[model samples]
Structure formats: structure tokens, C-alpha cells
Target: MLQIDLWKRVLIWALVVAGLVLASPNLFYSRVEQHNDAVKAIEASGATPEREAQAAAWPSWMPSNLVNLGLDLRGGAHLLAEVKVADVYKARMDALWPDLRDVLRPERETVGTVRLQPSQPGELRVRISNPEGMTRALELVRGLAQPVVSLTGAGTSDIEVAGQGSDIVVTLSEAEQRATDERTMQQSLEIIRRRIDEVGTREPTIQRQGTDRILIQVPGVGSAAELKDIIGTTAQLTFQPVVSRTSDAETSAGVGNEVLPSLDEQGTYYVLETAPVVTGEELVDAQPSFDQNGRPAVSFRFNPSGARKFGDYTAANIGNPFAIVLDEEVISAPVIQSHIAGGSGIITGNFTVEEATNLAVLLRAGALPAGMDFLEERTIGPELGQDSIEAGKLATGVAFALVLAFMFFTYGLFGVFANVALILNIGLMFGMLSLIGATLTLPGIAGIVLTVGMAVDANVLIFERIREELKTARGPARAIELGYEKALSAIVDANLTTIITAVILYVMGSGPVRGFAITLGLGIVTSVFTAIWVTRLMIVIWFERRRPRTIEV
Candidate 1:
């Protein structure tokens, strides 16, 4: 009556062994982490002698996954950045000019000459020589409006067109602005994540905070400034037709052109077309390499659409200067000698090898849609992290020892069974965390310590029930059977409620709070399993072998 099936016993033991094996990697966290990093490097680039040696530091067959340490535990850079979302509004308006010009130019006979009139940052104002044709001009410009591709913006156009005297004013609709903001935030998060990931940092948290702000936490980075340099560079590479090269910064760029200072030569500027032939967004790959003269450079390849555009621009503009612009600065302006059919090209600048590599990384990660103003930045040192880790270890060890002592002193042999299960429960929780690549923070450690005390609750319930049954003169076997049976519902009900609470916390929380919730939730599940199954099995095996007529719980 108090027996488990053969298969069930085997399955339970197998799971326990497997969990302990998975968690064993954490015991040698530093060595395993080094091995993992070396393995990743060897996979990314061919294995070198140093990397190979590091990779062999840990056994190949052993589990290598470790619980990722959070920013607070590992210590690194934290930044709160407010994105300049209004920057995209100006860019949008500037881009609309070309489309508006192309559309209105076809109807020149009716609308007369069109001129761009600069207004506010977000508005594009176009003036026609013939004011009477304003209706036709507005209609033609409004034709360029597309339906906003968002659920909340259904049936609404992206641009709102209005007439103001002889000018046709165009601005983004409210729906489109909301959609753009969402897209900008998402893209910023992704690009920042990619940039940090490229640097091989562990578990960097890049997430949107509010409407136009981002919170970036990178672990293992040198400093806040270093982290900023990695993700904050706009890296907005563009190839534009050069209107003229000038030494004076005050040179007028005229309509549809922009003047940018040169990066390599001070006091030199290039007036370039407002619209680029190809942007960094179109780049499929970028790598650090050398130019013809063996100087540090970035070699880049374009996607198919970009390749076609670049090839067409090069063929049509042979002998004309093409400006390579990066973040409103001209990196180079070279005269095109012949048609460049392929989409591959080299970007040579006054760059060191490090600069070239950084540029390549940035280009591969893609440009930020808007600039960020860092509102808060802090650099946490490894010494602080080590202190936190030591404190956590002390707290956890104290909690574990106290729990083990209380259970052993009160419940005797049965308490020893609960203590073993409790230890295994911790191992199982860590195994789950390592398997899922969960990040453990200071709060998560607190959660695990809390779990240590809670893990013995089911055992106490069963032991108390057995004490009650023994007083009723039931045999040891029947008393044990009734004890487990009576405690089952209570154990499930209590742990289930706690698990639900953890789930809610995880859903509502962010960062460290989520880390806490993860550990709490997982600990509850593992605790329930060990309490209901592992401790019971141990007691059953002991009772079967000894055949005790009367047992002390």
C-alpha cells in the first residue's frame, strides 16, 4: 500500500541524478564559464592554441551551462537613455521632400515650379508658383500617404496633408507618430542588444523603460563610457553624391543638399545630396579589413536591393565624387573612376585598427533610429560584485544550516530524510536555472534562501500526521501510508498558491524582480517534488528493510 511502482522509482531517481549533474557545473562556475567562452570563441573564429587550452579546462562530456549572474551580482555598466524621438520626425520630413518633388514635378504644367520652404522640425512645407493649383498639389502629395501598418492605427494614413495659403504642408499623423515611436524603441533595444552581444558580454539587459527611454545594463563591461561607446554610436553610414567640396564650413548646401565636416581632414567639408544612394541599413555584412594601401578600413557588402541601387548609382555617376557619410560627418569623398557592378566596397578613413573593428561592429549592429541622451550612467566595479556575492553566500549558507539543524533536531530520522530532499531540491532548482539560462541576482538568492525553510513544510505535515496516526494505534506501515495520504492535498494546495504568486510577480516585474520570481517559482516546484516523492521514497525504503513494528517519526 505504501509502495511506488518500479518504473516510477527509476524515473524519480533518474531525474534527481540528472538535475544534480546539471547543477554540478555551478560548483566550478569560473572554470566552466571560461570553457564556455573559449568554446564560443572557437566556434566563431577558428580555434587557437590559447582558446583550445581554455576549452579543455572543463570536460567535454560534462554539463557546461551555469546560472547567469545578473548585473548587480556581476557588476558592470548601467545607463538610462532618453531617445530623441523628435529627430526621426525631422528626418521623415526631410525624406518626404524628395518624394513630394518627384510627384509634383510630373504635373509641373499644372502646378508650376515647386520650391521647398523650411518650416518647423516635423513639418514639410512646399510652395508652388501657381497658388490656384494648391488643391491639385495637395492631392498629388497626399497620394504618397500609405496606410499605417499597426493594429491601433487601422485605416489611418501615415501623413496628414493640409493647405496653408500657397503652401502644401505635410506632417505625420498622430497614429503614425505612435507607431514610429514604438518601432524606434523596439529597434533601439534590438540594436543595443546586438552591439553588446557582439562584444561577448554575458546577459546584458537592454530594454525600453518609458515612452522614449531605454535602460541598458551590461555585465563585465569595463565602464559606463565603454558600454556607451559600444551601443551609443549612431553609425549611420550613407553614400551620397557630392555636390561640392569646400574648406569653409559656412558654405550653403542649397535645397536637397547637406554640408558635413570631414572626419579625416579638419576644416574641410563636403556638400552632399540629402538622400543617400545606400544606407547602413542596407548593408548585409561589414568586417574590419585593410584598404589597397594596407591601412585599417571596413569592408562592407550590401543586400540585393542595396546592391542594385549602389550599382546603378555608381554606373550613372562615374567620374563624380561620392561622399561616404557617417553620423553627419564625411569619412571620405572619392571620385568614381569606373562602374562598380558589385555591391562590395571598402571604407578607408583615418582609423586605427581598433576604430576599424569598432566601426565594423557598429555597422553590423545597424544604426540607432535616433540619438540618445544619457540621463543616468553608473559603473559598478567587480569588487562591489564580489562583496555582494560573498554576502549572498553567507546568507544562503546560514539559512541552509539553520533549516537543516531544525529539521534534524525536531523530526529525528524522518527529519534527516527531509534534509536530504531539501539539499536535492536546491540542486534541482539550480539545474533548472542553468538549463534555461536564467540570470541570478541578489534578490534571487534571497528567494532561494526563503525556499530552504519552505521545503520541509510538506515533510512536517506528513510527520505530524504520522504522530497523530501512531497515537490511534495504527501499525507503522499503515501510519506512514495514512500520513502521506492526508498530507498530499495540503502540500499541493500550499505550494500551488505560492507558485501562482511567483508567476504573477514574474509577469508584473522587470530585471531583478523577475530574477527573484524565477528562482522562487522554480524552488517551489522542486521543493514540492522532493517533499512528496524523494523523502517519502527514502522513508519507505528504510521501513521496508528494517521492518520496524513501531517507528519514531
Candidate 2:
């Protein structure tokens, strides 16, 4: 039992060497991080002399990845936002109006004139001038309904069309609403992720909460307000045909049209078509650039389909003006000077360079389908984070020292070997974490502390069993062999159960709790390897070299 095979010895030492190598970079985290950042900046922009020197500070062959600090540890902002899913329902209904009108206009003589009427939220109400043709009108509307593809609502239609008296009430069905909510939440999550990723924040958590809410945690952001400023705006950009331009705020554009106030110019209102000619969804790319007058502006290009439609519209209405609306506010109403065939255009307004850059970023990330209601927002200060980190280090050091002292007092030299293996176990855990780029939260520190105690249990079990065997009159080597063999099942059972719990926590938990689970789970694996392989290897080497007649534990 003491002698290991040649390959097994090689494999164990190789793993130890790899762990140490991977874990070494964390000792100089700030320097490596700065070097990595400088390298990325150089790659993004041109490699200037200063940036080249900064990049040269760390060698190219050295590992640059560090264990990412969580939002709680790094100090950042946390936001819980609830998506306005019902808003999509109204939009769906509004979008349906044009198609419905186009389909029913030809049947007007038979089905009567279909006039839009006020109804409940998420419902499209149409009043029929002729009451007798209600059934036919209902049939026509029902024909436009599509099948809902949701797993839970496979057999249902997308919308429920019903007629009461002289009106038809069109509402999104149970299936469609569920599908819409899922789609909206997915889009919201993606957009939020893109927005955060665009800013290059480290290890941001953008995840969905429940059915309609999203939880966002961004490290290194100044405040909740600052984070909100980056991604809070819906940035709903639309190009709507201009109906009229006026200075009167009270000027109503009548039915099928709406008036919006100018964003930059005071008292200027623009009456525009309710339906957009092109939306931000059609945008393929957007960048901050300069206008003809050298003013800050955003240039955007649309996809092929959008470009074709835009080109056709511009070609037909060269002298007419169109309003560029952002989040329902009119940015500008510019005349179509020529046929814009390439699907690219510049948006000019009273904008600073920063404003133009941010707008471009928003446009590139795509528009949110619905608005978000921020339910909770908070900022964690860097000072508090530093305090937490310092306290955690102190606690870990104290725990490690106490454990080593106790092990040495009880088992002498063997306890020293166990302590060495324990330290390596922690090193291996951190190496795994750095390799995987896992975030270390405050709870994750607690996990490592818990692991320090757990890591020594297997060694204690084997040592106690060896003591028991010695008391029973067994030879020293035989006692040691039986001790490790007998303790194997018990150690495996204990670690396996703990690992199962950690897995459950990781799967079911969120944010900091999940971070704790990750560290705890990795700690278990590393501790098991150190106990079974590393500690055994150390004992084998000692026994082989000494050939002691009698040994103390």
C-alpha cells in the first residue's frame, strides 16, 4: 500500500506542479490585470509606446486569468428590474390594426366600416357600423390568428377573437401572452447583457428573476444611478413619417397620428405617423461619427430588408420630412433630400460627443421590447468591499494556523504532512477557480473557511484508524496500510454527500449563494484529491526512505 506505481507517482506530481503553476499568478493579481487590460486596449486601438511598455510589463507566456471578484467583493451596483410585459400586449394589438384593416377593407360593404374603439388593456376593440355583419367580421378576424407554439399551450391560438353586440374584442390568448412574456424576458436579458458587455465591465451578473423580473449586478460601476444611466433607457428609436411640424403643444394630430415634443428644441412639436417606417430592430450597426457640419452625430446602417423598404420610401417621398424619434421624443424632423439607397443615414441633433457615443452604443445593442420598472437598486462601496476582503483573509489565516497547530500537537510529523497537503488543496481549489474564471463573493470566502475544517477530516480519520490498529498489536506498516484502506469508504461517503448538497445549491440558488456553491464544490474535489493522493504520496515517500522500526502516527 505504501509503494505507488511509477505512472501514478508521475501523474500525482504533475497535477501538483500544474496546480502551483496556475495558482501563482494570483499572487500578483493587480499587475497581471493591468497588463492584460493594457494589452486589450492596444489590440482595440493602436499600440502606442506607452501601451506597448505597459503590455511588456507582464511576460506573454505567463497566465493572466485571475479569480474574478463578485459584485459584493468588488463593490458595484445591484438592480432588480421588472419588465412591463403588458406593454407588449398593447403594441401587439396596435401592430395588428394595420393588417386587420388591410384584410377587412375590401369586405367593408358586407361587414360594415370597422372603426377602432377604446377597450381594455391588451384588447383591440372594433365597432361595426352594421350590427348584422358581426359574425362575418368576427370570422375574418379569427382567420388572422396564428397557432401558438408553446409547449404548455400547443393546441391554442395566438389570439382570442370574440364579438359582443356590435363590436369585436380581440385579445391575446393565454398561450400567446405566455410566449410573448418569455420572448420579452429573453430579449430584455440579452439586451441588458449586451449593454453591460459593451462597457467591458468584469463579471457582471445579468440573470432573469421569476417570470417578469431581471437581477443585474455589475462590479466596478460607481452607483445604481450610474448603472441605470448606462442601460436604463429603452432607446426605442423609430423613423416615422412627419404629418406636420408646429410650436403648439396642444395641437392634436387626430386619429392614427400623434404629436411628440422635440428633445433638443423647446416648444417644438412634431405630428408623426403612429406606426414607424423603420425601427431600431432593423439596425445592423451604429457608430458615433461627425455630421457634414462637424457636429457629433450617430451613423447607422440597416439590414437588407429594412434598407429596401427605407430606400423605396425615400425614393417615393424625397421632398417630404420624416421624424427621428427616440423613446417617444422627436429628435429631428428632416426632409428626405435624396433617395437613400444604401440604407445608411446619420442622426444629427444637439448632442455632445459622449451623448453621441452612448446613443450609438444603445442603437447597436438593439431596443428593449418594453420598459423596465426598477424595483430595487443599491450600490456597494469599494471601502466596504476591501474591509470584507481583509476580514476574510484574517479569518482564513487564523483558521489555517489553528488547524495546523492542533494537527501537529495530536499527530506530530504526520500532522505536518497533512497540513502541507491541506495548503496544497486550497491552492488547487483556487487554481481551478482561476482557470474557470469563477467569481469569488463574500459567501464564497465563507465556503473556503468551511472547507479548511472539512479538508482535514480524511487525514484525521486515517490517523485515528492507524492509532487503533497500533493499539491492537499490528506492525507499523501494516497498521498504516489497513488504516488508509478501511478509512477509504468512510471518506468517500462523507465527501460525496457534501458534494451532492453543493451541486443542489449551485443548481437551485442564485448570485452569491451560487458563488458559495461553486467554491464549496470545487473545494470538495480538491480536498479529496489532496487527502487520498497527495497525503498518501507524502507518507509513502517518508516510509520508503526511513524504513523505521517504529513510528509515532
Candidate 3:
């Protein structure tokens, strides 16, 4: 009999209604977006009257989830940046120098006086006064080497040590270099993501391109330069012992020391030890606040490890000046008044309120492991995005109208049923996208238009089968039942193949390609549900109410 179970019928209608309700907010996209933003702001900070009104623009009980727009649709900043992975090598070698000096100090009778010598980048050279103790120096430095912490680098040490005349040269091994490059790239991606998320942008794409390059696409940013400014700041904060303050920029910083100009004082340079007491990586929290003199400053709190190091350094070096360095420039050189405990400190500089807040944001987000050189940069204007949206709307409307007209005229009453189901299917597809928070691009719109055409295939097959069934002298009810049963295999087979293809595309592709795959995959699921179940239920209801003796297909 051409009848659906009562529970099944009710479930079908419930799903249809739910999908349409979930998709209804997209009809007033801008208003719902503003309401969603207002709600988020109210949660983050207390709501004002204007924000309250915006939040009230939409009903509270309704679903507020929206399909996020992609970079193409929303307009954004695009950048291809090459990371300077070699920069980390220099820092690694500099940090190794202090450890090497400490280890060789015990052997001063044999190794004589161990002194840091100027060397090329990525190499640490230590010169000993006595050449006869070269074997002892090499043995001690090589003893400090540890096995690389990687599967491919198993059995290889992190550093390679060799004797060159009276100097011992230490450099990172090849396996360790590869590991460091991978770590540097991963850290850069994370820091860039955090920095962009701090600004509250939607669905920004931050991904690694090659071995040492990153691709960043941020939607709703004003320009590429603005996006760069937000993420490009290295914000590498370190506290080091200040050797001396000098006005001569060309003055030699001496071995194991570097010269950095002061941020607040022009023409003032400070020579500081290359090794830091504590780095920004140890910081747990940073916030903008006022100092004792009521000036804008950034207050920072460190983790336990950082706190211990900072406290020990300050306690042992009372009255000695320590340089606070940011991105290789000395921000402040302040004398330690006493043992500053608890690992909390303030960085006071010549900064406006906005600068202090931005600095705090960068500090909280953490520093990039390596510097980035912008290889390609582009800014897409919102006006262009609006034009693209309008074009997509026109194409979708035309395709929908054409499909609806063709379906209605070709199969008469059955075609009208298919048309109604098609509408519901479109709504269901959007509902799924919103629920999943999928990003919609221009290619995604094309997938929707394509779906409108493919959605009526099942109904057409069923209608043709019924036409043949009616010729074989079957009763109207039996013909309709057999028609649906026969068409079910074909519909499932066709949609199943398409869904598999969509899955493959999604897995192998990226960015806009994945957007298209998402829409296509979701469309097939909704189309199959509407074609096989919703249309059948509607036809069953009509036949029951009419009690027609015969039906024309």
C-alpha cells in the first residue's frame, strides 16, 4: 500500500520544518550577523544599550549559527611569507656558548682561559689560551651533545663539535637542523594563528606552503599591510644583563655581547649579553596597565620556571642594570633595586595606550620562532566581494527558476511534488552548512546551482516507472508502490557515487576547492532525503485524501 508509518511521516515533517527554521536567519544575513556579533561582544564584555538593541534584533530561541563566508566572498588580506629558519640557528648557538663556558670553567688548569671568539653565523667558536688542552676541550663539548628527539634523527646528536687550531667550533648537526626547521615552521603557524585570532577575524586561513613558507588569508581585514602589522611583529622579549651603556653605535660589544639601541632614548645604545635570563616563551600572561608613575605600561607574569630564573638573576645582581630587549632592540635598561620575587614585572616605555595594548596582545600570543619576509601580498576590497555575491545570487536565482519550471511542466502533478521537495532540500543543505559552520565561497555557490538541476532526477525516474506500471494494468496504489521501489536502487546508486567523489575532493583539495566539495557533498545528502522520502510521503498523503481510482503520470 502507498502509506508511510505515522511515526516516519511525523519525523519527516519535523526534519523539514527544523531545516527551514534553521536556514531562515540567512534570509536576513546582515541583521543576523550583527546580532551574533553583539551577542559575542556581550559575552566578552558587558553590553551597552546599543549592543542590547542589536542583540534583540533576533529572537533568542532561534538558532544563531551562520555559514561563514570565505575569503573570496568576504574580501580579505592575502600574504605569502618566507620564514627565515636560519635565524634560529644563530640564537641556538649563542645560547650554547654560556653552557659551554660553564662546563669548561672547571678544567681551567688544563684548558687555560676559555674565551668566546667571534665566528660566522650558526657557528660557536671558543678559543682557549693553551693549545695543548685541545683534546680535553673537544671531549668536554662533545659530552654535552644529546641525541636528536626525532624518529628519522635517531642516533644522531644535536650538535657536532670539532677542533680548529686553538678554537673549538660547535654547530648544529644536519638532523637537528631539519628538526629545528620543522619546529620553527609549526611554531610560526601557531603564533600567526593566535595573533590573527586575537583580532577576532572569521575563518582566516593560516597554512604552511613549502618547507619554509606560510600562506595567510584573513577575511575582513582592511588591507594586507594591516594584516602584516598584526602578525609580523616578532615580539621576541628577553631580559639580559646589560654590560654597559654607550652613545657610540659603532663601539665593539666585545665577545659574547651585542649592541642594541634604546627604544625610548635616541642615540643611546646598550651592550648586553647575548644569552637571556628569561625569554617571552616563559611568559604566561601579559596585560596593559599603569605603572607607579601613572604611565602606560605592559605588566607580565611568568611561569614557574621563568619566575625562578628571573628571581635568581635579579637577586644575585642587585644594583646591576638589566636590558629588556624586544625584537633585538633594547626597550629598557633598568637597575635591579632589590630581589624582585613572584616572577611579575612591568615594562615601562615611551608608549601610548594603544601601543601598550597591542604589545600586551603580542606578548600574550607569544613570539614567532623566526622572522618572516613577505614574498607576496594582496588586498581584496569588499566592493569586489559584494559584486561577486550579487553575481552568484543572480546565477542561483536563474538556475532555481529554470529547474522549478522544468520540473513542474515535465511530470505534471508529480513534478510539482518534486519542486516542493527541491525547495526543502536547498533549505536543508544550508541548515547543515550552518550547523557545521562551513565557509561558503564562490565555488560553493556553483555547487548549489548544480544541485538544483540534479535534485529532480529521482522523481523523473519514478514518474517514468509509474507510467510504465500503469500500462501493465496494475491498480493505482500498486503501481505507485512498485514505481518507488524500483526507482530506489537507481537513486541511491547515483547519489552514492557522487558523494564518494565529493569526499575524495574534500580530502585531497584545500581552500576554495574544499568549500565546493562541502557544498556538493551536503547537497547530495539533502537531495536524496527529499527525493526518496519527502516526495513519497507527500504523494502518499495526496493519494489517500483523494482516493482516486486511477492516476495519470
Candidate 4:
């Protein structure tokens, strides 16, 4: 005979899981101010083209919303970016053919004109007048010696322009195609992350899923329409127009910073200026750090050329403040007190460590190649989120009560035992959510409710089978034994199917769908233990103590 204490053991296990789930979220990132309002969630960047923009990702405490609410159910921006494979191929050709032309110094007498075209595998085609010059060009290309940093491939087939007449087209070698794919995918992701940072996406999550596909999720974004405006903008960048501050009077290089005045996008007057310093193009990496007194700062390393330029510039203007301008807001304006000879330096500002570190990640990723297109944007008011959460709780409570009542009325003592286990199952799921630190969306609450309603199905299967065994005129002990044994196969099959389905959903889906799948998956495992072991132990204990010779439903 099973002991009543056995059910208690399973119940206790359930409690431990519940406790863990409830304590997870607060364990990560520390915060300065709590979020009280979503409408005023973040400081407004004032207004733009009749629309106001707010930081939608997370609080200043966390650089990423890696654990925050996703779009759909919480609502935010969605964007799709397609890397320019064609432009990549074009750049390869442009860089290659020029060098190949220089190499093919086919005696000017042998060839009049050499033309280039595209081919498969991202190779370029080069053609020269006079078929005989092809041999010379090919030979020159074969023997060509120089570093082709971004462009690759050598020899006749690599420079494959074998058509008729004076023009030829070159195709990319397989190696070149492979290299470009990697560069574009990596660069595109970094560029998107940078633009999001520049525009102040608090904790935006940008990841690459496939070769050319990137997935971006920004939480608390209030304007999806604005995101559509930003996401598609090519945003290409380069180091151009390097001029001294004295070159333009209107551009102004004011000395002695007694609050230098500047203009905002609206052409309004504002005091800003620490004079012009070098742009961010030459930066290699940046990280968030703390100073000697533990104040927030940003540290950065530069490329060799940039280091030389920086050392020279600081040596020349030791007392002048150099502005660290980003997205047109002067982030910092520190005086160049001495040479940064080691090619690395730090940016100190009125910043929290998180904010400073995020800025470094942005700078390391480099400026966007072009101005952004806000493909999507939106925000969730905290009031609404809180209200919805409360409503979900009420709904879950009602569902649980209804399920408990139905099960108890139908199955009697065993049903009561299932009810107790179900409560613990609920607690376990919540505790795990807290422990795992998953963001709870409205759909996630629905998942919990659905689990509550469906979790008892397994218990019902076992109980009903027990009833069937008793109808065969079996003794109480024999009935309960056969009941659980006979039903185990069907129980296993059903739950396995449910688990597989959840796995497929989680694997293929994103955002809320994924959240729903996780909750459902966890529910299945918890339900099996409660239904099979906890409920059975209670039933057996009751039978043993009461000594009921005949079973009662």
C-alpha cells in the first residue's frame, strides 16, 4: 500500500520548482529607477516630423532587452533587412578588375580596350582587344603579386572573361563568394545594431538566423511605423571630408568652452561644442568600464593610422576640448591633455556604467553605412501592461477554480488529490519563469491558463482507466494497479506528441509564439508527475486505510 506521505513528497518537489521560478528576473541587472510609466517610459527626444520617439528597449540599467517583452502581445517594431549581395559582387569586380588591369599590362600595342562583366560564383570577367592579349593578361594575372585585401582569386579561370571581341567579364571565385557572404552577414548585423544604438534602442536584440536573414526585436517601441522608416535605409558609412575646424566659419570651432552654442535638428539654439575632434571611423573596439573611483567610462582602441593621427592631434592641441559627436549629439567633449601613444583611450562622461558600455559596443560596430529607415516602432504603456497582467491573473484563477471543481466532483477523493498537485504545478511554472528570467507576455499568461485547464487530462486518463478495471469485478488493489499500468502507454503517447509539437513550435516560431511553446512544454513534464505519482499515491493510501473492499468512483 502506498503511503499518504508519498503524495506529500511529490507536492513538496512541486513547491521547490515554484519557488525557483518566482525569484529569477530580479537576479540579473541592477536598476537605478524602477519603471513606473511606459508612456513616459524613457526620456523623449522631443518631436520628429510630428512624431515623438522614446527609448523602447529597456531602462538605462541594461544595455539589451535580451530578456524583455517581444513584439506581438507586448507590441513593438519589426524590421526586415536584405543585405545587398549584388553590391557585394559589384564592389568585388570594381576592386578586382582595376588591379587585374594594372597587372595585365598587356603591351598597349596588343590590346585596345579591356572590359569586365559578371560571372557565377561571384567572379569577375575581364576582356581585352586582340585574342592574343588574353594570353598575356592571363599570364600577368597569374603572376600578379600584391595584396588584394577585400578581393580574392587569381589566374585565368578566376578572371574568366572568355567571350568574343575586346570586352571580358570576370566571375567571383567560390572562395570570394564564401568570403563576401560572411562579411556581409556579419557587417549587416553590426550595422543594424549600431543604428539601433545611435537612435537609442535600449536593449534591442539583433541576431542573424540564416545566411542573409537577420532577426531584430525591440521592446517597448511605440512606433512600428517609424521602424519601417529606419530599417531599410542602406546606412553605408566612410571616412570622408576630414577638414580642420578653421576651414569653415559657419561650422565654427569656438575656443574656450564657456558653453558653446549649437543648433538642434529643428534649427533651435542650444549650447554644446567641445570643438571638433576626429570622427568614429578609425575605432577598432570599445567597451564599458569604470574609472579609478568606480565612475562609468568608455574605453576604446584605434587602428594604427588612427592612433598616429590621434597622438599627433592631441600633441598639437593639448588644451582644446575634442567633441565625441554621435548621431549629432555631442556625447562628450574632453580636453586632449596628453598623447594617447598606446593607441587606446577612454571616454569619461556623466554616464552610468551600462550606458557607457553600450556606447562602446555601438562605436565598435561602426556608424551605419547610411541614414536609417525606421521600418517599425511602437511602445507599451506600463499602466496597460500592469492591467493586462492583473486581468490574466484573474482569468487564470477562474480557470483553476473551475478545473478543480469539475475534477473533484467527478473523481471524488482522487480528484481532490489531483487538485492539490495542480496548484503546485502552477506555482512551479511561475517559479521557473522567474528563475529562467523569461519575460511574461500576455500570450504567456494564456499559455499558463491553457496548461491549467489541460494539465488534469493525464489524471483523468488514469482515473477513468481505474474505473474501467473495477467494472470487471476486480478487487480494489487489483483495480488501481491495472488502471495505472494499462493507461501508461496512451498517457506516454499523448504527452510525447504534445511535447514534440511544442518543440516544433519553439524551433520555428519567434516572439510570443515561442513564449507560449516554452510554458506548454514545461507544463507537460510537471503534469505527468502530479497525475501519475502524486494522485496514485493518495488513492492507494485512502484505499489502504479505509480498507474498502469495493472501489467507488
- TM-score of every model versus the real structure: 0.96, 0.92, 0.97, 0.60
- lDDT by residue (tens digit), candidate 3, 244-354: 999999999998888999988999999999899899999999999999999999999999999999999999999999999999889989899999999999999988998
lDDT of each: 0.92, 0.90, 0.92, 0.62
Q: Pick the candidate with the highest lDDT.
A: 3
User: For candidate 4, lDDT tens digit of each residue in 125-236?
Assistant: 5567678676665556655433223545433233333444554545555555665577777777777776676665545767776666666777566665565544554422
How do the residues 137-248 of candidate 1 rate in per-residue lDDT, one tens digit apiece? 9889999999998999999999999998888999999999999999989998899888889889999888888799999998888899999888778999999889988999
Report the C-alpha lDDT of model 2 over 1-553, residue by residue, as the tens digit: 4678989999999999898778887898888888877888787556888888888888899787789888877899999999999999988887787778778888889888988776677888888888898878888989999998778889889999998898888999988999999999999999999999887788999989899999999998999999998778889999999999899989978766789999989989999877778889999999999999999999999999899989999999999998899999999888999999999999999999989988999999999999889999999999888999999999999999999999999999999999999999999998999899999999999999999989999999999998998888777888888899999999999999999999999999988899999999999999989988999899989999998878897
Clashes of 3: 0
The weakest ten consecutive residues by lDDT in model 2 span 37-46
Colliding residue pairs in candidate 3? none
Model 3 spans with C-alpha error above 4 angstroms: none
